[model samples]
Target: MVDGAIAGAVGSAALNVVSYLDVAVRARPTSSTPEETVGRLAGLAHVDLGPEDRAANRRSGLGAVLGYAVGIGAGAVLGALAGTRRMPLAVGTALLGGATMATTDASLAVLRISDPRTWRRSDWMADLVPHLAYGMAAAATLNRLRPPSARCG
Candidate 1:
C-alpha cells in the first residue's frame, strides 16, 4: 500500500511535468475542466463553497486534490493487484495509462465537463502524452519497490 501510494505520487509528478512542458511548448492555456468538474460535483453534493470568488478558489484547489486522489488511488489499486507479480513493462504501462485516462475521461464525461468524442486530435495528444508518462513512472516505481523475489511477468 505504501509502495503504491509512493509510486502514485511519483507518477503524478511525471504527469504534471509533462503537462507543464506541453503547455510551455504550445503556449496553450491550462484546462479548466478540473475546476469545472469540482463545481459540478459540489453542486450535486449541495455543498456551498461560500462566495463566488471563494468557491472558485476552492474548486481550483479541490480539482487538483481530486487529481492526486485519483493518482494515488490508482497506484494503490495497482499494488494490490500486482503484489509480487509484475507485468511486462509494455503491457503494464499501457494498462496503467489506459486505466488512468479512462478514469479521468469517464469522470469528466459523467460530470458533463467534456465530451471525449468531441475532442480534437491535438487535445487528445495533449492528454495522452502526460498520462503515458504517468504510466511509465508509476509502473517503474512499483516494480523497483518490489522485493527481489518479485514474480516473473
Candidate 2:
C-alpha cells in the first residue's frame, strides 16, 4: 500500500509536469471538460455550491483537483494489483495509460460532457502524450520498487 501510494504521487507529479509543458509549448487553453463534468454531476446530485459566481470558480478548481486525485488513485490501484503478479514494463505502462484515459473519457461520455470522437487530431495527441508519460512514470516507479523475485515472469 505504501509503495503504491508513493508511486501514485510520483505519477501524478509526472502528469502535472507534462500537462504544464504542453500548455507552455502550445499556449493552448486548458480543457474545460473536467469542470463541465463536475458541474453536470453536481446538478444530478442536487448539491448546491452556493452563489453562481463562486460556484463556477469553485467547480473549476475542484475539477482540476479531482483530475489529480484520479491519477493518484489509479496509480495506487495499479501498484497494488501489480504487487501480486508483475507485468512487463511496456505492457504495464500501456495498461496504466489506457486505464487513466478510460476513466476520464468514460466519465465525460456518461455525463454527456464531451465526445472524444469529435476531437481533432491535435486534441487527441495533447491528451494522449501526457497520459502516456504518466503511465510510464507510474509503472516504472512501481516496477523499481518491486522485489527482484517478484519482478520476473
Please list the residue runs of candidate 2 whose C-alpha ends up more than 4 Å from where it truly belongs after superposition: 84-86
Query: Residue 65 error for model 1, in Å?
Result: 0.7
Q: What are the per-model numbers of colliding residue pairs?
A: 0, 0
For model 2 the TM-score comes to 0.90
Model 2: worst 10 consecutive residues (lDDT sum) = 78-87
Candidate 2 residue pairs in backbone clash: none
For all the candidates, what are their Cα RMSDs to the real structure?
Answer: 1.1, 1.6
- Which candidate comes out best when scored by lDDT? 1
Best by TM-score: 1
lDDT score, residue 82, model 1? 84
Error (Å) of candidate 1 at residue 116 is: 0.5
